[model samples]
Target: MKGRGFIFAFLPLLLTTCIDPFDIGDVVNGQPRLVVDGLLTNQPQAHEVRISYSSPTLNTFDREVVSGADVFIEDENGSQVSLIEDTEREGVYLTPSNFAGTVGVTYTLRVRTAENVSYRSLPEMMRPVAEIDSIYAELDSRQSLSSLGTLLNNWGMQFYVSTGTGTPESNFYQWKWEETYQFTAPLAREDQIIQPICYQSGRQFNQLLIGSSQDFSQDRIGRQPITFVSKNTYKLQQRYSLLVKQLSLSERAFNFWSDVEVQRDTDGSLFDPPPSQIIGNMVRDDDPEDIVLGYFQVSAVTEQRFFITRAEVPASPGGPIGGFSSCVESSEPPADGNNGESSGGPDDGPPDFCYDCTLIQGTTTERPSFW
Candidate 1:
């Protein structure tokens, strides 16, 4: 960042950076603020709105729960639905399965913490979403160099969604994907397979996609890529299924997400606006200037699901990579000698990490209902 090649004063003019106004170190000096995250959807069954508190600019995921509060949502018709805290989950408030928002209706959330602090969201009208015309998969391949300096061949499938939007007012949309795949792990004891099958499901993370049709002429997003799977990984080794949720966002919600996209894309240069705190419709009723992080909105959602098997990618020039993860299986007995081994007492077995696939985050032995 130094030297004569680029002027020091012009550094901000070249490229922008993505950092909140406060450095991470300021977290200890800053006051904790409320983080409101969730949405009211038309298809909602026991919908949840999470309330937690955390100061900004820290690299920690620990957020204190704002619990023991009265939470409820009021519809434009003046009907109020109370939310009860989930005894099983901290900071999560849930509504009845029958409680679902309706399209074209505005809803506002109100919360009064046990500490007597009150916060509310501006009434957000439930927007309308375009239905997905179709979802298709395309087998693709690419080459790259591995860290081991070897040529790598990768194959995968790219999933896309098609939409038909003839209306002009419905110009903003958001997308999120949930993928579940079956992984079979062969657990062996002493050379013979003890558990030949282990089924686990996983959900995709950080697959963010947003589109605004304001610029295009009447035509909505035709073919938008949702997610891709690299064949080199174990995800595509067996059967895989994906769920795509298309959400209709109000112009305000669209703009909020757009700013998030911009801040994520910038490098803190003059070309980009200086990084500032991004807050949504949630505000404190007690203090007007108090900054609350996160947003609450009502959205109409349409979802589509796609299923694919290894046989679908026929052109890929390789055999299936079984989902078995590489790990050191010891023939020795456990240090505690309490583990139930075979009659001989000391049989070779896979480690708990590999044997119990649930060790992986977000994995469950209970298969998804759709699968």
Candidate 2:
């Protein structure tokens, strides 16, 4: 036989060139992914759940603080609940301080990872929408929290919902706004209190302005406007509870924040000069007049479009009338009206107040009252 067919074609090419140290790099390693975002709205007693991850190296060692992972919750006759890990804020996974999620029940989420890596989330069903047609307060002189300071005081609150009718397009609606402030006393120290300023995304009517007035170019105020009603006016409040879930597609984790290095004094002559602190977690305040500084927490998901009619008062372009009385005339000045003349007054020389109005180019040197 031709030497047994050349030993069966050289023994299958020597067993395919024998090499399997567990398939070496199995095509270049890198396999460990999981990201699950959870949200249930109707706002009131909204529980908590925030998980984050994604890393291959921004500096390596990516976030995995599931606080001892392994979380579970299932109900629909299977009855089960297990969720814990939120000691101040670690990887947030809390739910069971008197469990609340009953609108017809259907929930599931089991996650386990200590490197064992096993993640799942599939069943989330509960829908009951409609409740909240009253919560109003007005005195909004076009809203302001500190364009410079002092303008109608600052106040915001408007939430109205009295509508129902879905399944006409696979129904997917979400709205959550909760405000609970009960502090008559207890806080003269321990600063950092900026809660529930605003957050609206009732399915893409995007708006988030929490902690207003560090002056990114001031416009701050208790801004409000979220409307959509047509469920025969209103009536759905036995405490109100509407939950509908079934949306989880995890795996896209990459949270990076580290890019800040500002030091400016092109030549406005340092009046105090001392601001170059960039210690990560997302900090940026080279102080043009003050721009976004530390304290990280940002979330986004949008479709955008929210409408409400009625509030259109415009018709006053008539001629002059002098002596202030075009209806109690007043239309400008007051945003700190030039903040103490740019904070250096004692007759500071060479300050015709425009050394290019405080040059700041490279290392963010504060300038721009309107620069």
Candidate 3:
């Protein structure tokens, strides 16, 4: 089966089977509806796993707890690891220790319920993928807007992520990126500009996955040059994290009612069936940590630009308006393939680059950082 763009598209087919008279009432009360939400990518890390269940909605009074369910992880070497419940939380189980899943190792999961129903997942292998080397960000000038007689400038940052592996021709991998920003405003202030942004992309099957860069960009806000009084410097800090995961093509089907077998009485009466066979592809060597762990690699850079009243002012004691700090604290040359040049550096990187300005000795109280 072709991989769907969204994971939720599998819900409809997951709930119903091909059996005729699909009326859910034919099943016994309190039939279990299990949901497994985590699938690990080939990255080596520890990830969280969540399994939940709800009673058949059609049968109202059949609600029951899924407690006492046994969950375990199995590796390719026939090693089994048991999961324990979280002390601070209920109904959630976590691996006893962290495990970094390696490529070429197959993993599977086993779940045994209180009612003696069993479910297993097909063995999944972690596929090798590229890792991001660096990310570059620059101001986006196309999104400026004019409002209330003032040319309010909205700021946008474009990102370019470099990977060490070559692009693949087929077998698309899902990518997720998140950014966290911090403002100079007080921690209690709710109006800060920190927010989370995300984007998704995929690669096709049969394609050669090679080392290269993938472009993913997003506009921060609708408005530009956030209008504000001069002289006040706002500090903006941002950090980014990326996650890539390969999904399996085959899906496992399980019976909602699995424990008890149903039969017809001698008087032509029907007995309530037990939970439909809780069936799913048995995962032979499942590793809970790798399935949920997000391979985390982060890179950060910061710049401060100020708004000023006069375009041509005497050189201030602080520094140039568009200058940037050194990428590394030490004097060691930047790492190869690491493009750490600033807009205005020893060679004068870019002309339009302007750094935030401070209150100069002779300037007025209101000094603009960047226009």
Using Cα atoms with residue i matched to residue i, what is each candidate's TM-score against the true structure?
Answer: 0.75, 0.24, 0.41
List per-prediction Cα lDDT, in the order shown.
0.65, 0.28, 0.32
RMSD of each: 8.7, 27.1, 19.2
lDDT of 2 by residue, 39-60 (tens): 4322323245444442323322
Worst 10 residues of 3 by lDDT: 292-301
| CA shift of 105, model 1, Å | 0.3
- Candidate 1 residue 210 C-alpha distance from true site, Å: 1.7
Backbone collision count in every prediction? 6, 7, 60
- Least well predicted 10-residue stretch by lDDT in candidate 2: 13-22
lDDT of 3 by residue, 1-371 (tens): 12222221111112222111111222334354554433443333333344545344655234343467787767789898776666664455656445555565676776776766666665765544433344444344333345666555443333333333343322222223322221211122245354222111122221111111112122111111111111112212221221222222211210121110121111343554433323334322333322210011111111222222222221242222221222223222122121222344445422221121111112122312221
In candidate 2, position 189 carries an lDDT of: 23
lDDT comparing candidate 2 with the true structure: 0.28
Give lDDT for model 3. Answer: 0.32
Q: Lowest lDDT 10-mer window, candidate 1? A: 1-10
